[model samples]
Target chain A: MFFKFKNKKITNMISIVPNNIIKFEDEAGQYNFPIKRTLKMMDIMGYKEHRLFNDSVILSDVAVYGLNYMFENNIINKEDIDALLFVSNCTDHIIPPTSNIIQGKLGLKTDMICLDIMQACAGFVVGLLQSFMLLDSGSVNKVVLINGGTMKSRVSKKDRNSWPLIGESCSITVIENGGNNDVFASVYMDGVNSNALIIPAGGFRMPSSEETGKLQTLEDGNERALDHLTMEGVGVFNFVQTVVPEELKKLMDYAKIYDKDIFAYLFHQPNKFMLEKLADKMGMERSKMPSNVVENFGNSDSGTIPLVTTYNYGSLFEQEEKTVCFSGFGAGLTCASIIMNFGKLENCKLIEYGKNR
Target chain B: MREKILEILQDLRPELDFTESNDFIEDGYLDSFDMVALVSNLDKTFCISILGEDIIPENFANLEAIENIVKKYK
Candidate 1:
């Protein structure tokens, strides 16, 4: 779908990665021998370290930290937010929505709308879309879009595919109802490729059982129980390479914009290699597209777009606005792109979740 | 053309010896990123358009298979 949002604006965005840094080389040692070779492969793939939270920390804790930061720094008045939307594949409990927990923790007003969206990678764009929609109705003046909450506590220690790459993070984008700039977004989905990246068990479809919890080593050598995340890396990479560029081109063409008009192509940090290939296929300059987030902070999953945005343009957003694009593609075989005039993102800062709070 | 294809593969992922593995998919030598690079570079290098169907495991199985795909397009 194509959308041009005029009323809603992402005024500020702040992201936080936990204090704990999971270095690839140190962790790869546990898996043993092929460590050298695997490390080399990882190096080429543009992974160095991923941030993980201790057992004491939960997904909502990371999100609340960003929220508290925004409040303490006077970025936004809490009463102004009419809606609280939490988008993530992870939550504290399966029964009571994670948004409910966050709403209570943040002590939001009773009149506020709180919703939890169970989505992965394409979440940030979707979350923004939801916020824009809410604001377009005119009743809502502000919406707090929270992208994160997935915990890796369920990830098996033996699973290399997910452990080193998936970092724990949360990003808070404050969307408000005043902006003249146009926001163009395109979202595409193919549930046929849902299994490409999924946690096979633990859902209502196949409730987690003793059998489902059993960890087995597959032909690829990585071992993970059905309850943990399983990603068909190749399938996702191919999907992104094939679909992402096309979606990007369509969004750009519909807006009558080109590569030169964009200041930066902010993409989900699938990894360095895939981002490079996506940029190449789009016929865009590599410098215009940044992938340093994967190397520095690893894939923050659905939280990656805001995570990388804070990491790369944290300073830039504080200074002035520019024309930019954000794309998130991953699990659910989903792809989303947003081309918007970057307005002043007030008080853009990234902090270690545990370090401060 | 085959040498050029190998060169590009080697360039993309010089960490592992591309020639050593005949099984790119099963061997875990080349991943989807490598495959994307391979397709994009082969198109640019050989001046031949590689269809999406041509990006299967068989075409990228080994240096010989990659060479065959490139040669077919050439």
Candidate 2:
């Protein structure tokens, strides 16, 4: 579907990644591939250092830390937040929505709307879409959209297919009304192929068990269990290379945005290879798209797009306004994009989790 | 078509010969990233839109499988 909002704007954004770092070389021994092939694959896929939260930490912990940073820095007033949209793959509990937990923990006002959006990969864009909708309704003046998760908690350590790619971070974006330009966004979902990327167990459909948790080598020669997150690499790659560019073109066409008009294509970074291929397929220069996020901090699921924004152009965003586009795709087999005149943020930066605290 | 497919594969990983393995994906001759690059190259080269469902490892396992996919799309 297509959506255009005239008054919604993202005024502040912050991405917080855990301090613990894991280098690809250190964990190279865990994969199915030989050392030589592993190194070669690393070079090709741009696998390097990634941030993972320790087991004791959950999504809300880092999110609260980020929120506290924003509150303490005077970047935003806690009382002004009209809504809280916590978009994440990992939840504090399957019962009480994590958004409410965050709301209660932060001691924010009770009048605000609190929602927990169960989404991954495309989450940042999806969250932005919901926030835009809320702002358009005029019920909310400012929405705090938090996107991120403890992705590693869902990925098996032995599953080389996903382990090295998992990173955890939380991004808090303040979306409010009274914007200058029109915001164009689109969402494409293919639920039929949702299993292409999924956690086969842990829900009521297939409850987690000792059997489900039992690790076995899969066809790809990677060890993972039904309880762990699994991805059909080729399936996802094909989907991205084939469908994403087309979706992007539709949004660009609707927004009347061309290659030269965009300052950056801030996309959810799965890895260097996929992003490079996507950029190539789109017939755009690789420079216009940043693909170093996965290499530097791993793919933090839905947090990647905002992570890319702050990591790459945080300083620039604080000073000027530029036409930018954001796209997020994965699990749910969901793909979404947003194009807008973005910048001059009161806060656009990436802060370490505990270091900021 | 076979020669063209081989050329695309070679360009992606010039170090490996495409003919030696019956299963390029299983033998590690081609990885997921390679498949993506190869698929895009094939789409551009053959003017065929290979659907996402047709991109499994089996379809791109060998030259014959790849050619069959291209043929079907054609």
Candidate 3:
């Protein structure tokens, strides 16, 4: 589906990553491949270091800390937010919505709508889509979209295919009902290929079991339990290179904006190789698309795009308005894109959360 | 068609000699990422859309396998 929204703008964004970091080179000995081969693979796959919290820390814990940071810095007022949207694969609990928990933890107003959106990499754009719709209703003036996941808690360290690339971080974005430009957005979902990226067990359909928890060496030589996150890497890579560029082109054509007009292509960073391939396929200038998020912070699920923007542009987003493309694709088997004159933010920060709290 | 397929493979990973190895995947000449890229290049070059189900490793194992895939789609 395609959408056009007027006057809904993302005014502030803050991406908070864990303080504890793990470098790929240091952990090369753990995988099935030889250390030398693994190190070579690391360079090929663009695995550098990833940020993850201790097992004790949950998504809400880091989200609370992030919200507190914004509150402390006066970047966002707690009372001003009319809606809270938490987009993540890692919710605090399956029953009580994490957004409501965050609201209660922060002591925010009860009257506001608090909802949890279950999504992965394509979440930021999906969250933005929801926020824009909320703002369009006129009842809501401000929406706080919290996107990220403690994905390391799910991916097994023994699974070399996914472990090194998974990073944990939370991004808090404030969207409001005041902008002068039109925003173009589109979403494409293929539930048929949902298995491309998934946790095979631990859900209601396939509840957690002792059998499911038992780690076994798979055909590919990676050891993983059914509960561990698995990826059909080629399927995902093919989906991105084929589907994403097509959808992005359609969005750009609809928006009537060319590559020259785009200030940046803030895509959800799967890794350096994939992003470069996507950029090459789209005929986009590689410089415009920032692919360093994976190497720096790993792929923070839904938060990666916001992490890309804040990590790359920083305060520049607050100083000037620029035409930018924001894309997030993966697990939901979802690909989404949003284009707008994005800038004039009160805060655009990338901070380490665990160091303090 | 074979020349086009080889050209696509060569363009995707210029370091690897596509003709030298019968099993590009097993020989480590092409990994999963390369397979996807190769599929994409073939799809674009031949103006044929290869469905996701047909993107298995065996279909992209070697030059003959890839050529067969392109022939089916074309």
Candidate 4:
């Protein structure tokens, strides 16, 4: 339910978002939902524009692009990356994990640990938790943690609930040892309610079929097929609102840290509206928390937190040390958070996926 | 109290006329995110704590309903 990791610092965080942008107003015509209501919903949902992958650009491409940037910039030595943990829900195929695919493409060493963990929204923190545990055992000195996916691939053009809210990007973080164990993390899940946000079909439980692929309208006046990732927007909003403030209090209590001591609170930017509400409920100052990453790059799921880190606070982190807190909730019907002292970043770059790769 | 609540909700969702409509949730004018935000600012404005159970639809259906719940703490 709750955990802590110390003696490891997130040395660097690199983010990549596809070049394409999908405007909400332009897509409203396809939904046929009243334009007035659609625009209102977009404002309320904190969506303006979201990024989508260029067909050729898979989640791995953007992630590998960020990785390659880090290497070329002399931010990280490719050989020092021993453990490669890729956390994602949307990949090229279900059989061979995306981690192996990335390792193979990058030509990583055969002896390195390469595996994929299927996770969404809260992935970055979960990946950090796993990476910290791996290196704590004294086997490896550095770990490359990636949390990304071709998440927009799950968005059905027919489903308004997921339509405009889907934002895509990739985040790769480097974690290394010999730092103060000041980092604290907590991860929670509600499996019984996992279907509150899920892809009902395409998995073995109910494989994708022609029947599932056929679109049908629902009570909410939106259309979706069983094969697409369906989300109960209200359910997820309520789940996060009710659980996260308490989770934050627990995390602070465990770490013996208080709000006054915190320099920043970076949440996985689900959306502008959601983050605004959560900040109000948590009794936090808007400036103390950066909630605009979703608006800047769309809700690139796992990539959101790192994007916020590099986009908003990258420069600040480069100058001085700050007690920072991170929280992400979604997809798994899961939530994870970390409280750490953000130190100088040897390399934290927000790179765009170029046309070539 | 209703006027003050209106002032707060308006800041969160300036797109709609909250004072003109009584059917907030049903009309899709207010959903979960708005409800949380409305309740939060109300809690702050009225100095009342809104528990999870108090977050039912009827409580947030209209301005009058929100005022009624806020009156409970007073």
Sorted by lDDT, highest first, which candidate order results?
2, 3, 1, 4
Docking class of 4: incorrect
Which prediction has the highest lDDT against the true structure?
A: 2
Off by over 4 Å in 2: B1-60, B63-74
TM for chain B in all models?
0.90, 0.97, 0.94, 0.93
Query: Which candidate would rank higher by DockQ, 2 or 3?
Result: 2
Q: Which ten-residue region of model 3 chain A has the weakest summed lDDT?
A: A36-45
Which residue pairs clash within candidate 3?
none
For residues A1-357, write the lDDT of model 3, one tens digit per residue: 899999878889998888898998888889775565456555555788988888898888888999998888787888998999999889988889999999999999988999899999999999999999999998899999999888876888888778889898899999998878999999999999999999999899899899999899986678999999999998897898889988999998999998999999999999886787677667778899989988888888998999999999988998999999999999979999999999989989888885543
User: What would the per-residue lDDT of candidate 4 be over residues A168-233, giving only the tens digit for each residue?
Assistant: 788889988967657888888888788888888889999998998888888667788888878887
Which scores greater on lDDT, model 1 or model 3?
3
Q: Worst lDDT window (10 residues) for model 2 chain A? A: A35-44
Interface C-alpha RMSD per candidate, 1 decimal: 5.4, 5.3, 6.7, 5.4
RMSD, one per candidate, in order = 3.7, 4.1, 5.0, 3.8
Cα deviation at B20, candidate 2, in Å, is: 5.1
Model 1 chain A weakest lDDT span, ten residues long: A32-41
Model 3: lDDT of residue B19: 84
CA shift at A253, candidate 1, in angstroms? 1.2
lDDT of each: 0.80, 0.87, 0.86, 0.79
